[model samples]
Target: MSAPASPQELRKLIAASSWTGPTAGVLDGYQQANLAVVPRDLAFDFLLYCNRNPKPCPVVAVTDPGDPVIRLGRTEADLRTTLPRYRVWQRGELVAEPTDITAYWRDDSVGFLLGCSHTWEGPLRTAGVPVPHAADSMAPPVYVTDRPTHPAGRLSGPLVVSMRALPGHLVARAVEVTARYPTGHGAPVHIGDPAGLGIADLSTPDFGPPPRLEPGTVPMFWACGVTPQLVLPNSGAEYVITHYAGHMFIFDHHVDETP
Candidate 1:
């Protein structure tokens, strides 16, 4: 199928299950977000968690308790059906990956739209820094790191980062380009040495496929939206919800704009 031309159209396609895969590189100029829905009882702690760890869990739009439609930059996007895929968690364990969570939806569930690095791909490309995953039509590789997030009430765990192998020269341009977009996990957290982050092998990512790197390219790591997913197995929340590995929600806001 041809690509949906606008965020609303892409959302509609996702709602209808016509697109049930990673949302990377779609709706190029608009912002794509990682979804995190937790019971209202655990909302404050999670919100605090995002606030304390802005780099990895940057907040974009958050739905009020029980409200499915997002009202940040746009008012029409619904959390229940807007994302391509969703993951349901129980006692810190992921139990389901579904197209829609209407069956699990609760009136007290709060949805969070966290900033995603995919939102920075356009700027990177504009700066002459190639976005490898976008060029390959794949999701960037995400991995769990030894770096720990500050504990906020009930949530705390290792940081997760998405890896991008950059040409040695463009690494600086990539950093400069992404730094302007703070809400989208601005700049590189680590430019080389995956071992520094406790990542043993780039080939065995915790989520998504291993990256394809050229001979002279060096891996650069950026704070990833997958941080919450990594935290889930350790957070004590009775229930949690998130987007499946590479699946994300598209929002009407542009990358430079705060939602």
Candidate 2:
């Protein structure tokens, strides 16, 4: 891994296929995002769902149906092929994972840009908090909680979270630091006792590797951007498109501008 590139450079790298993995550290100072594409007919309800659940879905931009360019973010950005990868869903089932979605682009589809937690890592680091996974060059563990989200017109399901272990004494500081970035998932929803949140075992996260808890450290959970993507299937949408895993849409706005 090398120093992160600027949003514009990272976009070029992704466009050139030089990088095709999780974008956790690719554009350090820029805002990274989750993608959600839905037909125009369902756009209003979906936007309402995001507004109702801002923690899990902070809206950064919403493209006009049929427009591939999101005017709010990088003026020249193209949603179809800017990310390293994308997942395509049809009628609530994941039908394909594609590098590009040019073929699936529809004039009636609207693109939604949502805020992601990656934006808060810098604040944590600046506060002298340790982000073990990013420090060790690894991905953090993520899980689906039994905690159901507020429903809105076919959009409802359990919340999903990403787990990170912090030294017992530093956990409180971590929460405070992250809380300052409300648009980037402010504060943790659950701390300690994963089982209390309906999580079965720390060894088996729904996505990514099992967490490696350090001695005297406890597990901390934060609402994740993935919650919306995971719950979309149950939302009854006939089709949905989202970035695969950590592959995010790099935005032109600064992290503080996310809200």
Q: Give the per-residue Cα lDDT of candidate 2 at 198.
A: 97
For lDDT, the strongest prediction is: 1
What's the TM for model 1?
0.93
Please give, for residues 1-259, the per-residue lDDT of candidate 2 as tens digits: 3544577777777777776778775656567789999988888888998888888888878998899888774456889988889999998899999888888889898999887888888878878987777765577899999998888887788888899988888898998988877667788999999998899899999998887767898999998888888777666777899998888888877776642
TM-score of 2: 0.92
> What TM-score would every model get versus the actual structure?
0.93, 0.92
Consecutive 10-residue window with the lowest summed lDDT within model 2: 1-10
lDDT of each: 0.85, 0.83
In model 2, the clashing pairs are none
